[model samples]
Every structure is written in C-alpha cells, then in structure tokens.
Target: MRASLTPTDAPLRARLLALALAVAVLAAVAVVATVRAADRAAEKDRAQPGEPAAHAGEVTLRQPGRLLFRNLAWGPQRDRVSAVPLTATSGPRTSAPRDCLRFHAAAGTGVCLRATGGVVPGHEAVLLDARLRPVRAFPVPGTPTRARVSPSGRLVAWTVFVSGDSYAGGAFSTRTAVYDTRGGTLHSDLERFAVLKDGRRHRAADHNFWGVTFAADDSRFYATLATGGRTYLVAGDLASRTMRTLRENVECPSLSPDGTRVAFKKRVAGASADAPWRLHVLDLRTGRESALAERRSVDDQALWLDDRTLLYALPGDFGADLWSTPTAGGGAPRMAVRSAASPAVTG
Candidate 1:
C-alpha cells in the first residue's frame, strides 16, 4: 500500500515532478548535441572537392614497383591501405578494403595496426595476406605507433605507446611484440629479452623497447631500448631471446636493404624538446654515423626506397605526407607522396 499526499504535501509532489521533467529534457538535449557533433566530425573526414582522388580497388603485396601507404586524402577511402606506382607516387590511388593507422609490408605479408571502436576504445594488430585480407588479429595493449613485416615475411613486429606521451621527459611506457607469422608464435614483450648492455648482462625495471626492424635472416633484428632516461640501439636475436646494446640516443632504427647500414632518428643536442630527433644513418661496418640533410626533425622509422634513399612521413596539410632523402647525407628532402603515410615498397 502507498500513502496518499495531503493538500499541504500536494505542492511538494508537484515540485518534485517538475524537477524530474526538467532533468529528462536536459539529458535529451545533451544527447542530441553529442550526436550532432559526431555527425559533423564524420562529415569533415569525408573528402572535399579538390582533394586528390582515390578509388576503391585491389591492393596486393605481390605488385612490384608499387608503393603502398595509408591514404590520408580524406574521402570514403581515408585511412585505407592505398597503392600507387612507385615511380608515380603522386598519381591517383587505389584503396584497399581495410584500415590501418600504421602499416608495413614485405615478402607478401602485411601488418596493419588499427583502432577497434568498442565502448572503451581498443586496438589490434591485424595480419594481412598478399591480397590484403585478414589472416589473423592480435590484441594490442595500447595505442599503436610502429609496425613492420620482416624482409622474408616470416616475422612481424609492432610497438604501442602504453603510458604517457612525453618522450623527452621519460614519461612514456612502450610495449613491442615480435611474432613468427608461420604458426602464430608471439613474443609479446621484448622487455623479456635478456639485455646485454655495456658488454655485460643488465637488468632494470625501467627497460622499454620499440621500433623493431628485422634483418633478412628474420631471427636477427634491431630496435630501440630505453632505460635510465636514455635510448640505445640494440641488436636482437630471436633465437637467443637477447638484445645487445650498440649505440645511444638512437630511436626507430630501419635497416638497409643490403643489411650493411641502418637509418634512425637521433636526439641531438640543442634541439627543441618537442622536436628533438633528426634523420641519421649509421654504417654497421665502420660504426660511423652521419646526419642526413633533412633539417626537419624526422620521427618515423624510415622505409628504404632503395639502398640509396630513405622514405619517411612528416606532418602535412592532409594529416601527413611522405618524403624522401638521400641516405648518404647529401640531398634535399623531396615530397614523395601527398596526404599519405606509412609507406611500404612492394616488389
């Protein structure tokens, strides 16, 4: 049974009802505003007139002299894996039927790191076949930043920014995973790899690794290791589960096609905190390092257009653009592709 309101209480009951109605109305308005905001953002992502054209088409790893990249030229195909002739990178693009924030390919294999739009945002590493179809997907622990497929297509590596974002202040945590594509064997954390620093076995809880570049042998690799507020380039051996530190202040190492040199970003002295890295190359045989002519701080793991030139992405009007420079440290940076990023040279 419920008690009835008296004449004096009637006014109080009416006031409560009015309050509830007002609350409901406000909530409805808020919902509408949020939805409208989302719609506006989606519309903005669609390509406007004058944007370089892209069309839905097949993208494959088997196409030689083809350049693959994540298309940033807004439209129905924005963020799709796209391909153009390597010699004609500025030409119209053919978009694949998949999305990746960062992508790389080699030997008929691809690694696509993408966002999984769940109630709580998530991410995944989706492996791709020569046809760019999903072979398998693996859960990534955080925001994807770097990805690579081994020269032989038998190994894959990816890095995620696990915590924080300030690279120069040592406030970030990174997780790198290397996997064998043949049977889905994954080394989920390179931190577990035994560290041989200063020619001695070292241990520290602060260790973090990222930006793995594989050698042609697949078992051998290179990556950046961070500890003690500094980063070092480390040579890794999957067969032994160990990494030997080579040089300091080197990040995002990319091995050359001939396996004789490495291209990387170095945090040089007297650079701004926000943009502290410069493009550089190291001769593995002589231990000589030289800064490339690209004066702008390059932050991407470079892709080798050939043994002679390097490709990387920088901020551009359309999110990002690919640029190339001579690896021998003498040339101007040339724009290779507009509104594109994460380039993979397929052949």
Candidate 2:
C-alpha cells in the first residue's frame, strides 16, 4: 500500500520530464544545422573563380587591351604554331591552322606562315606579310632558331644554329643576322655569335642561342646563351658591332615596350630542379631587381601588354594557358587567355 501523491508534486514531475526531452531534441537539431553550414562554406570556397593559390611568380599589368597569342604544338613526331586572339570578355577569338609558326600585326591586320618546308639545312627563316601571306623565304646559312620584327615593322632579327648534326646532342653553333624589309637586303652579315658545350666537355663545335628581342628604339637587340650550368643575356649593339653581358644565369629576358625595364624568369637559390622558376623585373637604368609573386611551377614566355602589365604562360594540368597580373603589384592572377602559349599583345 503506497501513500497517495500530492497533485502539485505530480504535475511538477511530469513537467520536468517533458522539458528534458525537448532539450535533447533541440540539441540534435542544432548539431545538424551547424554541420550543414560548414559543408556549404567549404563548397563555396572551392567553387569561387580566380581564387588565389600558390603561384610561381608575381603578375604585372603592362597594358589594358586585348591580347593576341601564338601557340606552338610539339609532339614526338610533329611541331606547329598557330595564331589566336583573346579579350577580357570573350575567351578565345579564332585560331588559325596549326602550321602557322610566326606572326605580326598592324592596324587590325596580321600575317603568319607555316615555318616548315622552306627551311634549308644550314639556313631556316621565312618572312610573311600582314595577311598571313608568305612574302620572302630564305635560309640564314645555319639552323634558324629565333626571328623577331622591330616595333616599327621595318627591321627583322634572327639567330641560327650552325651544327654538324640535326638533333639536340649534335655539335652546334650560332649566327646572328638582321634584315631590312624596305631596303630588301640583309643589314648585318651572318656573324658567328657563340659556341655551346655539353656538360664539362666543351663541344667546341656546339653552340645555341635563344630568347631574342629588339630594344624600344630597335637600334639594339638581346639574346641568351645556354652552356651547361651557365646562362647569359647578351645585348648586341648593332651600330657598335659589340655584345655585352646584361645579366648572368638568366633566361627568357623580355623587354618592356618603353625599354625602361626587362622581365625574366630564373631559378632561385636552394630551389629544386623540379621547382618552378620565378618572374623578376629589372630596371635598366638602376639595375635594381624585384621578385614578383612566387609559384610552385615554372612560368614561361612572358610578354608585356604595356609597361605596367605582364601577360605570361602558366602551365596547367591539361596544357598551358595565358594569365595577367599588374606590374605595380598585389592581386591574384586572372585568366587572360586559355589553351594558349607564347602570348603577344598589340595596342
């Protein structure tokens, strides 16, 4: 026989039980909501475009305009180059056929050509007009490696490799030549430039030249020499007939349109061979240097859109693409062009 409970006590016990059950349900709902919110945040982060990630170097904006690019495709058996245009709003304009190797533009007109077929064993260079039409094709008495036009479109400079064999291991040498478009003659003789070597063995018979560019005034030009662990930037004065070392251990020197500065890529100290190179800007007047944003992989084929912006090729998983950054500094890179390489800009 149990004693009868008071009605007030009984109601109080019932209320406490109900409150505990409600609290447990509320806690469970809160935990689920918190987890869902966290997942949404992570998804948003990955979905955002132009999110800054580890980069190889700083990007600089040299000019504000559309960028026109020339892409080169090389496989185990074949090689070709093409011309394509890109703007901020539209991705890629139109791509020419794969055979086009070199190009130049003026007043909304451009020209390019298929750099095969006409190359001679000792000489290789083919000139084109503004409509992708082949103008004059000739050999430079050596294996032509690089060719570029003056800013005024009146002059052209090129480097050729004089070698005993066809492939990379062969003994090689270089010759520099300049041609006048208006005069219809070669300005400079096929001058012997440099001799390259493999390893400690000076393949006295081998030489290689690359990365050629003209000065702002087109009175002078520059190129690079690679021999084993040593690299050099050679500035040649056409009038003086002399070459000077502008920098050492540097490759791919790109001159600004104004000729006030030069941008290049190089290996940093303690950097692994697999580590990507960084972009650097050099003041021609002061000889001062500054590193751009750093990246994890190599950057290549840097070109100035203007003095303030730099457009370069950044390699991706599928292929290489074009990217732009401000020269003044700060801000992640933006995609200026996709599926592109060897970018050049015209104002």
Q: Can you write out model 1's per-residue Cα lDDT over 1-347, one digit (the tens) per residue? A: 99887898989989999999999999999999999999977975678777778999988999999999999997889999999997778889999989999999999999999999879989999999999999999999988899999999999999999997546667899999999988768999999889999889989999999889999988999999999988999999999999999999899999999999999999988999889999999999999999999999887899999989999999998799999999999979998999999999897
233 Cα displacement, candidate 2 (Å): 2.3
The alpha-carbon deviation from the true structure for residue 123 of candidate 1, after best TM-score superposition, in angstroms, is: 0.7
Which sections of candidate 1 miss by over 4 Å? Answer: 1-18, 21-25, 28-31, 34-38, 41-45, 166-168
Best by TM-score: 1
Give lDDT: candidate 1, residue 16: 93
Q: Which candidate has the highest lDDT of all? A: 1
lDDT of each: 0.92, 0.55
lDDT of 1: 0.92
The candidate 2 region of ten consecutive residues with least summed lDDT is: 52-61
Q: What is the lDDT of residue 331 in candidate 2?
A: 58
TM-score of 1: 0.93
